[model samples]
Target: MVSNLAGGRRPRSGVEPGTQLGALEAYAAQAHGYLTAGDDELSQLAGLLRPLILESWLRGVRAGIDPMDPGSERGLRGADLARYRDAHAIAPLLPLIDKLLVQDTARTGLIVVVADQFGRVLWIHGNPEQVAVATEMGVREGDDLSERRVGANAVGLVVRTGRAVWVHGPEHFLHRMHQLTGAAAPLHDPDGRLVGVLMLAGGGRVAKPEILALVKATATAAEMDLLLTAMRAVQPAPRDPAPVADGPLGLDVLGLGQPQLSKGGERIPLSQRHAEILLLLAEHGEGLGADHLALLLDDTDLDNGTIRAAMSRLRTVVGAALIGSRPYRLRAHIATDVEALRAALDSGDVESALQLYAGPVLPRSTAPGIVDLRDELRVRLRTAVLRSGDAAVLRRWTAGADGRDDAGAWVAYRATVDRDSTLYAQIEAKIRVLDRRLGADATRMQRSRS
Candidate 1:
């Protein structure tokens, strides 16, 4: 028998020992009532829930989800499901997952569920009876079990927190899900990107600490299998003109925070200035001369020699051949997160584009060009999303840090939703908050003027 981590059935801190279930149920009831009634006092009553669980409930409420609804609201179906499965990166790991977990899950009367990074259940296996029950509850393949769709669950919570978690009984936001318990862990590709979540789900009896450990171990094994598979698939390249780094060059510069470059699974650290230069060069595939680059690099006039010295240092850090000198361009193809985001946007794949855009481009950069590029990309992406008039997409944007303060997105979201809906009320509240903030700012400005 597995020992309970929080001393039994209570997955979070600050709960009374014997009243864990009661507390969770009470909190869930309070949250439900507050959301349904559009009361802002929910936060005051959230003391019974763990911070993470409470946050998940708030997100669900903001999304206008009905806790009583039994089915998932979005997912791929039939032919679409088939196509997605075939193209998914996790496809190769399914057999390995089956070998490791299916028999055990079947015997234990548990369901093994695999979901993509976005929380869409791609596959489920286990005892036929349990599978049927889960299917009836909308846990079948192709159903979106994301927090925004079906409230908190092991799969969605793991994706959201990027950690192993167990959601038991009343910890679930949806009333119908109170009958089930789940433990899940997020899986990552070799490059450290989230691939999906691997979960073990059953009744409340499955909430033991050992079960969480088992799910984590299984997730690790599957990730190792994926990594080994990826390694075997890559053929040896004969030789390169320049000294090649171990793996492909990957650059991530979306956020001002911790921009990184990886080569052969090793991190090559960059100075703030070098990061700015590389980002500028990557953005301008056609290449820029030293003078032009210097101008972009700083607002004031910078000498050509200063720019040349910086480029020389950068070449030494990367390879000399990788940085071409004539027009100043990268010789080899470098994969960048920003370019991927742009490609997705250009292809009209707004969801993909949003997923790829982690944050603004080198957000910390004070350089004129980098700042302009960042703003331009942000504006263009928002314009495209608003133009599409997709409520789901708009909600996703408004829910993120970048869009939380965006009054335009709130207006757009409100316009797209029905006025009588809970979602409309939520957006209206957000708009009111924005209005109050704007009013305060205007008042301050008037006082300053006087």
Candidate 2:
């Protein structure tokens, strides 16, 4: 059913709500034509859209999303969904969510949607009529609401932009979606990591400015509840150290440097062994067994006593409550430098991502898990830099600690940089030196094989 937002009323421009919406709907329709042609940078498109929406359009174009037929391309159901939902960080706050927001949205003609960082709908609730209306628009539970699925939506834009926003009629890439307006806010943990999103979708009733404020307020409350729950779960050890945040602790182990943890602005130094254990725990948020951790920590036959001794020392430093017993897991929230870098890359902010890369994760650590993590982070970051194809970005990357010796990156730099410049000679020299070094290594390997 088409919403009554835009009909026979000749919408006049100004600050009036209906007038602005009508004008936006007209701009969106005009923009939609340019979008389908895969050209978001047309000179004619400038000043016709808000900066944020324009940015999202660029991302959608790069992702090859078909604006004309944007449907949710992925979802989960039944047992698989149950397992994933239960394991999600937002799982614990389900009750708080229901009590705080769900109860009120019922029969109110507004549907509440809670989505994970990836824009997968984890929970959706509201009036049956509204629910049915939403279901017809492909906003069902487990559906992926990301740009790749349904272009230019509030949830997708929030996930990409990491900020709260309201998507008005016609602003959505799907023409049929013009019937609904969606307001959404990102929920964050203590360390500023995106935990999830809270959103409300409807028609004229949703156009109220208060709806956006309501979503933001509820999101804040939800985050507070998460903090409280994490705090309540702590079992601080007898030897009291400085008080840390109640939820997961902030872990900083990027590059070839000493690992650190934090309680807000206060930095806590961590021993190498402690960092390794903490890294493993953070990697496996669900939990890890003693036997499994031992294997990841070393190839040698490591005994439980050694692992116990390490845990004992770690518990004393971070407090026992931060590390759960049983199958070991990090009880507090862990905000890592690695996570921040990935978030930047996800949002298509390669420059910020490059700035966050100090080096490979734990560049000096030889532990199996740390080594794997270092390679994974380095490769991911390198790939993102290469894919960016921005000459300035390539220049910045090739000069960094991680990419200084990266011959492939230097080659890419040469391709992008001007041949008429003095820097051209320097880049060429560096590439040749790297190529020679690589040639020597390959020749040595061939001789060894013979």
Candidate 3:
């Protein structure tokens, strides 16, 4: 970042030691007025407002968003809103957010806000009265608080710069928001993609340093949860992919090709249904019952009889000695290609993981469990590959079935290779074709709005 990025010789709004709150707010209001009125004395404004806030104010001015008027801003509502948030990658980690932020703020008058990378608020929980106050300031669920949409605010600042930020009182461009303060930090997925933002806001003590610290900590916890969830596929299964003499088993469920089993060093043929069951069993050591398998094996939820029949046939093929009753788990310890992929990922061996990832697991299987597992594995490997920034690994992935049409992978590949190389032009051609499909997600993931 530029030394003068935040204006007053530092990239922040440095409050002087012992500066009164009233004085700071007065100076902040003056700076906001200057920016709104098209004042060019940036040096004077820089002394009062933060460089980040000034930048946001400039964009707000360029967009012609009046400081006196919030203008009309709408977000997903009702079922559209529910469906969107449920489908989001952040959906699984809401519980973690609750434990880390909301519960502790019960009596603090602070409200927690979770917003997609687009700055659209997805969830808001806090003290009832404070929540209502936030709602009055347009911090309700489904509202867009992006820099371009709502000017300078913690959520908007985090979106613009992908960092933890705070917006106190008069720092907000809209007059209505001057009653509260907010601190927000970006929440990223396992692969380092910014998925959303976590924030805390209130009318009291919201500007305290601990507030930003807490927001940053909670955001980190959320990212770690994403990583752990991705790693859950790595249960207690033996790391060795080869079948061992200790009554161990092996299963291969990746690729567009048929899934197979390896027993006593001999490849064994298996039906698609059998493959799905074994893969699920291998990933889940504790095993699953027919009733549970019924839901996972099909969208319509197969009957107990059908699930029993499939398990019965599977038992015979793999030998009953290798299988158990009741929950119907594999009696012998097992290793799988999926586990190997996770090992590669866990060790940060992105290249090895890329090499092991021949394709998505049982790509043709419509079984719900298999689909979720497929996505988990694919997403982990893909995230690792992109973050690795290894040209060869990226090239290999782009050549594979899954990555061939992956626009994001191609774009990352473009960055790692020589700009003047023939390969660069080739990647460019590929990106152009897939560019339209690249960023139709969460409003503004590909680029932060001004």
What is candidate 2's lDDT per residue for 20-76, written digit by digit as tens? 676567676676765565442333333345556655665566556666664543456
Residue 313 in candidate 3 has what lDDT? 96
Off by over 4 Å in 3: 1-12, 16-20, 39-44, 71-73, 234-450
Write out the backbone clash pairs for model 1: 247-264
The local distance difference test score of model 1 is 0.73
Is candidate 1 or 3 superior in lDDT?
A: 3
- Alpha-carbon TM-score of each model against the true structure: 0.53, 0.55, 0.50
Looking at model 3, residue 14 earns an lDDT score of 60
RMSD of 1: 17.9
Q: lDDT of all predictions, in order shown?
A: 0.73, 0.72, 0.74
Q: TM-score-based ranking, best first?
A: 2, 1, 3
lDDT of 2: 0.72
- Which regions of candidate 2 fall more than 4 Å away from where they truly are? 1-19, 38-41, 70-73, 236-450
Number of the candidate with higher lDDT, 1 or 2: 1
- How many backbone clashes does every candidate have? 1, 5, 1
